[model samples]
Target: ALSVLMPKVKVKKNAKSGKKGKDKKPQPKVNTLISKPKAAASLRRKLSGPEDVPVPDDDSGDLDEPAAAKPAKTKLKAAEPPTRLTRGQRKRQQRKENFLRKFELANLIGKQEEAFRTGSLANLADLTAHLEEDKAPATAKGPKRLGRKAQAAQDEREMAQFQGVLGFKAFQADPFGALEQHLKNSIRLQKEKEKTAAGKQKAKLSQLKEAFRSKKRLGTVKNKFAKSRKPKK
Candidate 1:
């Protein structure tokens, strides 16, 4: 009777007013490291939506469409038959046979697994010993790096390939003076052009003087009245 009355009173109060704590919003999650960017609403943000899907030129539902569209399939693959074996395949088959033979000799020491499951304590101990040995992890070793001489030879080959004819010509044309003489000649011609441009101001000033003189009657004065003043009246 007391428990029923207690819940009824609390329900009546909840109906009248909601609790302040209950009304409060949950806290937003805070990232301690990298956070995803809020995507902008358009293509300017560099993000694509599902509707902006890219369509390939040959998007036909057939798998062979791309293969058929490809030009002549110019791959220089050897024309060996699929059933043929390369040298590596032969080596792998030999290795597999050797491994199976070695495994058979090793397993001959132990009887069938069923015998051990229903056998004496000594057999049980031997099985446990075998399992323990199998579980013992082997130490793995990495391949050794190339020696200094090997590395130097590899770098020399690379340089010879990339440097090709340009480097060979440079070395042959001038062992002591690379292409410095040719570079100097180009610089000298550029400086001569600059000097000619500077002298153009003098030529331009002489042209201006000639143009001024050609604009008139000669004497630097309008003295026609002095020459003919009615015979000195």
Candidate 2:
């Protein structure tokens, strides 16, 4: 006879395990020593001290006395050497100086000629003063001296005038031409003066002739009247 097999029973597990309940974050192990407030207060009292240290007030007499005025430091400027000029700059400067010198010389010459024409010694005095200035000594505190070429040029200029004649380079270059020009100018001026005088004389003569003619006409009219009054003789 076959025995009937009994069906296996399935038991349901407990949803909450005793181990899980026991494992629960083991109550964060408290540090009893550190957690004692009384102990911490006693330790703090032992470590700390009184903070009231006294500082002495400054008693030096300097604090009471007026500060001596510090002597003002005068900044002495170092004398800088003159800047060296470039070749082109030097050339340009030389040219400018030459032009200025020539212009001044021309002006002086004109003044001298004018003085001569007007018979005045004032320009001569000025020229002498200028010459004196040129001859003045050149010291560090005084005016600078002329260069060799410039001094030579000055000497030549001094020598150029002799007996009321100017032996200038322009005249020396073409004396005949200069003379011819001078002659021409004089002749022109003379002609102009003669022309003016002739015109003035002609005008005077015309005025006199007009006056004489008018007087003669008046006399003739008077004579005619006189004859008419005298009537048939």
* Model 1: per-residue Cα lDDT over 1-233, one tens digit each: 22322222212223446543454444544432214334323332344435655657775765565554556657787887778888999999999999999899778745556566667465667778999999999878887899999999999998887677356787587755756766787899999999998789879988988888865555534566567655854
Measured by lDDT, the strongest candidate is 2
The TM-scores of all predictions, comma-separated, are 0.22, 0.27
Highest TM-score: give the candidate number.
Answer: 2
Q: Candidate 2, which ten residues in sequence have the lowest lDDT sum?
A: 1-10
Give model 2's TM-score versus the native structure: 0.27
User: How well is each residue in 1-233 modelled by candidate 2, as lDDT tens digits?
Assistant: 01111223334444666233433333334444347878756655556655565655776644567988999999999999999999999999999999999999999999778878999766567788999999998766856799999999988877764523455665778888877987999999999999999999999999999999999999999999998899576
Alpha-carbon error at 177 in model 1, in Å? 1.6
Per-model RMSD to reference? 55.4, 29.1
Name model 2 segments beyond 4 Å from true: 1-169, 231-233
